[model samples]
Target: MRSSGVRSASALPCKVPYRIDIADPPDDALDLLIELGALDIEQLAGGLAAILPDSVQPEAVALALRSASITVSPAQGRDNDSVWLLRTAPLRAGGILVVPPGVDAPEGSLRLADSEAFGTGHHPTTALCLEVLAEIIAEDHPSSVLDVGTGSGILALAALLLGVDKATGIDIEPAALEAAAANARLNHLGRRLRLILGGPEAVEGAWPLVVANVLTAPLIEMAPMLVRRLGHRGRLILSGISTTLEAEVRQAYRHVGVNCTASQTRDGWIVLLGQASW
Candidate 1:
């Protein structure tokens, strides 16, 4: 899972009726809009822009925002699918390289078709998680792993490519599950990757390693469930959190019998590493 305070999903197709741009909002405000039901959000040059949910009107979005230098306008629909798909240069994270589907991928490279869902591997939070996973994979040599809120299935797929035998990716969104399946097929790891729709409760058993790169709030909310899903000595990687709230998230997990033994930060985002004791 990426930050709910994402810049926006303009990289993917947008059908939402109205576009709302808020100039230089407080960091938490964009996420509040998402919680209030914004869609296809794109981080604007200076602020943030998001399309109102189908049932939500621009006025409602503005009213909810309560005057934060907002501009509501009609969205200019896209004609070609290729134009909206996110196309970027190869991204390197630890031992992995994220490239567009057709581009050449050297060993340890991932051919990702960036879409509406998160986990493009470009976000600092995602990259930081991957980096930590690479190190953990090297040190622990786990055979299987679980990914919570697996967006593009990047984390799970990367684990398989790095030598994990099987991976289970769970998310609440059907669209995200679809994207993850497509990516698993794209990587030819379909046999090893399992995609499930819903949260961690939907899963049947604990895992040797679990990687969840979602935002701070969900991370905290899911702390107990995440802790319960870990094997006696399993490792946990939590990302997609702002640095400011790291303490809060760490405390949440700590209360559930987990402790942050290590952490990594990049560009105002963070990933916490912990182990389960109970």
Candidate 2:
């Protein structure tokens, strides 16, 4: 499950929407905005810009970016509708059709919302994970799945739609769990999906299929816990790692006796498939 950002200040009766414009933002500054839950980010000649919700304070965001030496300025307020101008496009991954809510999906397609929880199916990491999941399911059906950092619960929900009997999604953020639950209901898979509000420790039993789409540091840090949650002969699909960190992540899991069986890379992001030898 993905982590949540800091809660915003209490909402006022009326609020003005704003965009935070960063001048000459470095890669680290841009990453900071993403981690802080900036919904829409755009590249600019000067630096970068992000559209934040009305609830978020531009000053607060600027303060945070100060450490990275990025200068943030707030643009004039705009209509809320402009925030979602870039609608999420439908993604066809393997046998799954991931569409945003209210959009028409083909029969058997999975409908998800573009919520704050992440994993809308458009990201390279999520797409790579989906592709890996589809391949594995086609080769051998898995009875159950455990989705770690289940942002938007897309990975776990997709598994159920692809014939997995049941799935459990774990995340450290309540908002993510809420979004995942809503998506499960949207896809009409609520009964077969269980949402948890914690990390790997929140999961009690091992699963035949486990997928975690998280960054390299967290993935490496949770290697032992993740391996423990994988049933014997089970398959583990890990993503949200860059090509440069592939070796480091592989070694981390190898230390726990799991070997990378396959890997797929797209747009510099890589996903690894692993299995433990009994």
Candidate 3:
């Protein structure tokens, strides 16, 4: 939670620093770190550790990373997890501005913008959703997608890129909506992407594909509403719960007549895919 020198806007795309310290490894340690945004594998020096940025000079950062020095290693091999890369084009949603990426938006394309909320295909929940979205597009090819609790609009944007006819995203945070709107514009998906601020209470409709990557308790509480918003044979993907809580989440969804058809786990986090029954 501390830094050495002042970092200008250009120096760090993220306003916040990306240093996470974990004392002891828990049963699901790595997953927890990923959830907290430790994407680049760094070294462990003494009991403290440093998670440097993806662009930080390894040798220099490694020395800085090691204070009292004991051990260290770069976090790597993240591709093993269920994840997909996305390419976004510049777009304008809600009349907000967006800038296109210097690099191409991945195969599936959509509007582009940035947000303050955590996700934009960088986190595990969003990553899992993208992979699942790709599979769904390949198989069922649903026409519409509803991303509930759409933090940073990554899920909904992925749907648009995958040829979804339309995508509607809803979130409770104003900042998140702003971010979603910005991302939509950045990807040039303003016409196909709609960003709304609020929860399920904010909108209603049956979408062929619905994804909610929120926490376990909230997901379970919103199960009824999510089920009601799915078209017949609609698919649902739920995540943000660790593997330890998979059974409980599955049971909760089952109680609401949602039968989980498949599941993917990364670093102990579970993403459950299900279908609406009745």
Candidate 4:
């Protein structure tokens, strides 16, 4: 396990309790906890923890309490497991991410949220997509965007926030769709963001920008359908692949004439950008 620095307000206290409030916790806050290096988590009256790192300062703890309305605080240790604490941070790319205290969203413009279907913007795959999305939108605003495997609907919502006229988010998981819808509402994007509970097979019509952030196998399988759904001069972004798997995904798209020579890698994940061959 990696060690994190710990800080606190006062000197040498044997024990202390801190509170972190998350009015609306995201669906995958628990998972985020683990990803952010919370060694342990528990739901007592209310709060969460990890083993305390020596670098923590009490003043920092107090500051967190003041700023957070939805708080997660440190509690008593149990069974030889110390419970250090964590809280949520606001994500800038179109929505707020509310995870338990100590869990942080990924760096960059991507925000964090609790979602079981993944793609909450904390994942490397999602971060790469956000950066690429910004570049693509900067060149020219896309009128419509289709985000397949929409996960928490972060991609579609981000597009809508970045001036896409309308966005369609598709996911096969009902829970994912529900989470996406909730996130849309949180960002006040309910009107512009449409959440569809299905796969690429259910998507109809062409879009100027289509993004699919899913695993290698599924991406390859859906390449044909995704290619068929892009308009002339439209762009497609594929993510959720590791650098090791990039060649496979690129070759799959190449077979359908959607060449993905342009790609980005972050934290071992790859995002491929391509355009439909006319």
State TM-scores per candidate.
0.70, 0.71, 0.66, 0.66
Q: Model 4, range 186-211, lDDT digits (tens) per residue?
A: 66678998887788778789999999
Q: For residues 87-160, write the lDDT of model 2, one tens digit per residue.
A: 46677987799887788768889998777777877778888999999999888799999999997899999999
Off by over 4 Å in 2: 1-85
lDDT of 1 by residue, 1-278 (tens): 22122233244234545566787666676787878866467676888776665477555665556553666665543211211211345778878888988897686678777676788776788889899999999999998999998988989999998889999999999989999999988888899998999998998888989999887999999988888889978999999889999899989999999998799888898899998886
Q: What local distance difference test score does each model get?
A: 0.79, 0.80, 0.65, 0.67
Q: What are the runs in model 3 whose C-alpha is more than 4 Å off?
A: 1-100, 104-114
- A best-first ranking of the candidates according to their TM-score comes to 2, 1, 3, 4
33: Cα error in model 2, Å: 25
Clashes of each: 5, 4, 27, 29
Question: What is candidate 4's TM-score against the reference?
Answer: 0.66
Give the per-residue Cα lDDT of candidate 2 at 61.
74
The residue pairs that clash in candidate 2, if any, are 1-148, 1-149, 1-150, 2-149
The better-scoring model by TM-score among 1 and 3 is 1
Residue runs of model 4 more than 4 Å from their true location after superposition = 1-48, 51-87, 91-113
* Best of the candidates, TM-score: 2
Tens digit per residue, CA lDDT, model 3, 1-278: 22222222233223223343443333344444445445443335433344545444433432343322223332322222222222222432212222345645444444344334655454566667778778888899899999998877777877776678899999888878887777777777778988888777678778888899888899988887778888998899898888999998899889888999799877778899999885
